[model samples]
Structure formats: C-alpha cells, structure tokens
Target: MTLRAGVLGLGVMGRHHSRVLNELEGVEFKGVYDPSDAVPSHIEGKPVVRDLDTFLDMGFDYCVVAAPTIYHLEIGTMLASRGIHALIEKPVASTSEAANELRDLFTAAGLVGGVGHIERYNPALQSARQRIQDGLLGDIYQVTTRRQGPFPGRIADVGVIKDLATHDIDLTAWVTQQEYVSINARTTFRSGREHEDMVLAIGTLSKGTIVSHTVNWLTPFKERTTIITGEHGSLVADTLTADLTYFENGVRHHQWDDISQFRGVSEGDVTRFALDKKEPLRAEHEAFRDAVLSGDTSAIVTLAQGAAVVATAEKFVADGLEHRLTTP
Candidate 1:
C-alpha cells in the first residue's frame, strides 16, 4: 500500500520533506506545489506544480504542508476539503483561531492530521521522556530550554516564538505531561521586523513545574538544549548533537551527624547515553505516515496540542506588547 505523498512548499523544511518522502518506504514522492514563479533547479527531478488546483488533483493520500506559517490555514483547508490528510508544520497556523479552524476541518472530514513538532522525534528527547516516565528523574521541579541561532533567510512570516520557541513550549508540555497554567514573557525586536527576534518566557505547568525558555535568532552560535531538573537528578538533552546525559546528585558521608549540621554540596557523576541517532524530521514523517495508514495518532502531535502551543505563543506576544506599552 504505497501512500502518495506531496509537499506544499520547497523552502528549507519543505526541501527536506521532499527528499525524505522520496526515500521513505511505502511512500511515493508524487510531487510538490509552490506558489513561487520558478521552481529551484535543485528540485528538478520531482514534479512541481505552480497551480494549487493541479497540485490538489495529484491524488495525494497525504501532503506535508511545509509552507510558511501564514499559509497553513489555506493549504490545510484545501487539503482537508479534498479528503487529503495533512501534516502541517509547527505552530500549525498563524493564530490560534485559525488553528482551531484547521483542526475542526480535519476532524469533521475524518482525516489524519498532525503538526510537525519535530522535536518530539529527537532521539535524545525520546530517551529523556522514557527515562522520566521510568521514574529516573523523580518529581520534575523545572524544565529549561534554549534554542538560539542566527536568522535563517528562509523565515519571513513569523518571529522567534512561533518559528522556534514553539518547539520548546510543546516539548515542555509533552515531556512533563503537564498543561501550562500561566506564562510571563518579554520580547525584543532587534531585527526591526514586524515580529520579535528574541523572547524570554517563564511558564508554570499544571503540576507546579516551572518551565523557562530562552529562544532567539540573534545568537552567533546555534544551540538546542533542554534541561530537566527534579528531586533525584537532572536530564539534559542536546537536540542538535543528539546527546542525552544525566547528572546525578551526590550525598556526602558526614562524620558530624549533628542535628543542626548542614551537608555541603557534592558534585555528582555524569552519564551520557548512546542513542541510535537519526534525523528527527524523518522520524516525524514516518509517524505521520504510519498514523495515516493505521488510524492511530497517539504518538503524533494532535491538532489540539498544536492549537494550545499557538495559544501559548499568542500569550507571549500579547504580554510582550503590553509590557512595551506600559513601560515609561
């Protein structure tokens, strides 16, 4: 049962999706649709359609909507109307309201829909989730994430929050299995664009876990890291390097066992787990493909989660704007 797969864009992420679909088993890379006037020479081998109608008529069982964030709703609507399942990129839509519409449309059509929160498929993150579930991290106290890098020429429609930090927001909730209760955020527009280029946010999870995120497009070096601290130890994952490490807490053997004596801090051992590293995007594509084929969406990011992440990001932007207006 080969699934006919199509891609909606040919940008950075879309190009990767096209290549992966071409190589992915059980999926035929039918073609791609881009609104741009000229298709890049790099994409010469695959079929390219500039017309939306013709692209929709390609008989795609599923399509990857890797287009810009603003076009998500329109593309998703078209796909859903045609009974084509879609895997939309993260921050599913430009706004939460639009995300809800896409979600409902897909749900009403009985289509297999998923958001491309690729971090959920990172080998390190996957291992961390399993270990946390196994009670290795104990009661999670806080989760901090940092995703920073220079501005990519491909991004134009969204800021750092939507383009990058949404990954951390969704990841914190997924890894902790908790809902965000509240959030406080501040943003900066260093690039003079309509949207923010950097953001610092602190969020509270339902279980009293504090999640902090520092995401920006101004950093000279790229870093994608997550730290989970709990009662027993801490789990750290580096998404770019695919490294999962655990730092243990040490207990000092005190000779002065007095009632009022305090034990000094002890540096513990660090352990790095060996993981079978693979491209997270490929894993995400596989998950979406399998869900479309099996009618199971337990492992993929649901539309509701996508909307929730967007709602959270909206709060961040709103708060940032309010703060700017209130400042002297």
Candidate 2:
C-alpha cells in the first residue's frame, strides 16, 4: 500500500524531508504547506500550498512537521484533530508542556505520532545500540556526548540545547535503553541571542549510568560524537560520519608496580566496525512509515519519548538559569 505523505515546512529540514518522501518506497510525496511567501511555490515539481486549510485538505496519511519549533503545538493539534498521523521534528515542541499536549492529543486520536530524532537511525548509533544490548558492553558505566558546531542562521526559534543537544539527550537514553533520572546544567549566551548558545549538562540514568553532554553553537567545526564506556570497553560513535569504534579493556597486566597501581584500565585494541551508512533521515522516514502502516510504534520514536526528552531539556535549561554564575 502506498501511503500519502506531506511536509508542513519548507525550511532546510522540510526540503530534505520532501526529497526523501518523494523517493521513499511505498510512500507518495503529496506536497508541502508553508504560509510563507518567501518559499518557492513549487519544490521538486510538487506544489507548496500557501494556505493551511488547503494543505490539510490534500488528504495525507501522514504529515511531517518540520515547521519552526514555536509552531509545533499548533500544527500538531491541527493534524491530530484531522486524524492524521504526524512525524514532528525533534524537541517535539517549543516547551515541555506543548510537547505533552501534542503527545496526549495524538494518543487520544489514536494516530501514529512520531518525533524526527534522526540520530536514532544513524548506522553507527544503531549498531552501537544493538551491540550494547547484546552485552558486548558489559555493565554500562558512563555515556558522554559532544555536539558542537557553528550556528546556522536557519534556526532562529530555539537555541543550541533545543536545536542540537536534543539529539544527544534522546540518543543517549535510546542507545542505553534507559531514562534520565536527574540532570544539572550550566548555560552561556555568548551569541547575543535571548536563548543560550552553549550548555554543559550532567545527568544520571535510571540504571545508575552517568552521562555528560557538552553542546554549543559557537564552534568553528561540526562534531557529533557519543562515547559509551562500560565494564568491557567503550563504544564511540561518530554520527557525523556514521562510524562506530570499540576500545576494549586490556587484559595484559602492567609490570611496573607504580604504573599498575595508577592505571585503572590499560589501553586495548581499537576496532571500527563496518556499517551500511544509510542516510539517517531516510532511515527515520522509513521507520515512521513502517509504524504508520503496521500500527506498531516500537521501531519509531514515539511522541511520549519525544516529550520526555523535551521535559529533560526544560529541566536542564531551568537548572542552568538557576545556577548561572556571575563574573567580576
């Protein structure tokens, strides 16, 4: 069965979603909905509807909400009311409250609502998750992520945490199969924007694994890395290149007494696994499409999971605000 799909935004992500939808198997790219006159009238031979009602009337089995973060709640409400499935972008809504509202709305409507946490579909991260679950990483101890990059002018409604760090927040919990129990953070707004441009967050998961996230938009280069250290070794996943490497703990004993006493775990062999390296966005769309068709949300990131990530991000922001230090 070919499912009809539409995009609700024409921004960077929206355009990419449209392209993937148009190319995806068993899916039909209907068109796009963007009230902004700035966007072109047509993309890839598909009409870009200027009116929301007219766009909704086009009849889509699922709609990808790539609109600005501020408009997620409003757009999600409309889709839910129309009994349409939706795959909203990350940081599900502008606020945790709005995210929860959308979650409940979709749940009540019995619609297949998902969040575009594309990192979950990264080949490296996907491999890491499977390996960790298979006990390749015995007894997870810590998870650390660093996501920094030059700010893109395309994102104006939210800051680095919401725009970038949400990827780490969601992927960490997902790869570890755990939930965040507590989090503390500190933020800085060096970019002169109302929202923060940098944040350092530390949290603990339900399984007692510690996690730290360093995210910012002031870097000169783009880096997406997640390192999960367990009793056996560490799995380092570089999402930017879809590379996963494992650093195993050395079994060789140190000869020197002093060196052996100080060294906790000796450096072992490092192996980078080969991955399929499929485009994460395409994989994400495929998962959502499968969920919509099968009526099983297991393979997709549900709205509830997205809401939890937003709630955790809200706590991080609040903690940062409360603990902000002043310099003299």
By lDDT, the best candidate is: 2
Q: Pick the candidate with the highest TM-score.
A: 2
TM-score of 2: 0.97
Q: Which stretches of candidate 1 lie over 4 Å from their true place?
A: 41-44, 255-265, 325-328
Candidate 1's C-alpha lDDT?
0.91
List TM-scores for all candidates, in order.
0.96, 0.97
**Per-prediction tally of clashes:** 0, 0
* Regions of candidate 2 where Cα sits further than 4 Å from its true position: 254-263
C-alpha lDDT (0 to 100) for residue 234 of candidate 2: 97
Question: Which pairs of residues collide in model 1?
Answer: none
- lDDT per residue (tens digit) for residues 167-284 in model 1: 9999999999999999999989889898999999998999999999999999999999999998878999999999999998887776666832863435688999999998998999
Candidate 1 residue 153 Cα shift, in angstroms, is: 2.0
